[model samples]
Target: MHWLVLIISGVFEAVWATALGKSEGFSRLGPSIIFAVTVIISMGGLAFAMRELPTGTAYAVWVGIGASGAVAYSMMTGAEAASIAKIVCIIAIVAGVVGLKLAS
Candidate 1:
């Protein structure tokens, strides 16, 4: 259950990150609101998960999910350049996150 929460928190990290980018420095009301709300939820989930998971591993997983999701979204939306290297690196991050989970 803690792992589930942690994974969800990581997903929200991506949600907030994407919303923040769309917020245009908090100028846009909708995206800004989305960013604020998701950030809180994401952090809350992270904190909850931290009660059971090791801090270092949890943080790494959280960051890995967020970064991987954000990059994938950017590429899919044409907001960022896509390349094989970028995809491979994102996969590596995900693999590392999974490896950590398995090792733990």
Candidate 2:
């Protein structure tokens, strides 16, 4: 399904984003490879999903997933602060993603 592909792409987007940060200007080898691969796969999946899903809706969803997942991963990995405000913002992003999907 297109939706499934979109969500999977979003997940890959998150992975690539986090990996990019860890890559440290591409100084790191492993994470850099992961970043490149996931980024390509994520974009490819997004393009495929766009064939059926509206561009705006799919983009918003993909961004929402990447943002939320990256923040969560950073917090869990102790790479970023985990504050109440951050959590609230992530929740808001989720709400917006859901609203867009429902309204579409």
Candidate 3:
């Protein structure tokens, strides 16, 4: 179940990152609160997962998920421009995340 926790943590990482972007330099109250809360939870979950998962593996997966998810979310929400190159980069991040997990 460690891997499950790690995945959940990664999801939370995505959430917090998106929230941070919406927070608008922390001027927006609601998103700011959400950003803070999710950041804490995401890190907490990562700490728990690290008890079993290797540090390199867990950190790479966490960062990869956050990066890819943020870009995808931005694209879907029309918050950022989308392009073939962006999509390819997202895929590459996914592959790297998978490769790290598999290597561990």
Displacement of residue 40 (Cα, Å) in model 1 is 0.7
The list of candidate 3 runs beyond 4 A from truth reads: none
lDDT of 1: 0.97
User: Model 3, range 1-104, lDDT digits (tens) per residue?
Assistant: 88888888888899999999889999999999999999999999899999999998898898888888888999999999999999999999999988987887
* Winning candidate number (lDDT): 1
Q: TM-score-based ranking, best first?
A: 1, 2, 3
User: Candidate 2, after superposition: displacement of residue 93 in Å?
Assistant: 0.3
* Angstrom error at residue 71, model 2: 0.5
The 10-residue segment of model 1 with minimum total lDDT is 62-71
Each candidate: how many clashes? Answer: 0, 0, 0
Model 1 superposed RMSD (Cα): 0.5
- Return the TM-score for candidate 3, rounded to 2 decimals: 0.94
TM-scores across all candidates?
Answer: 0.98, 0.97, 0.94
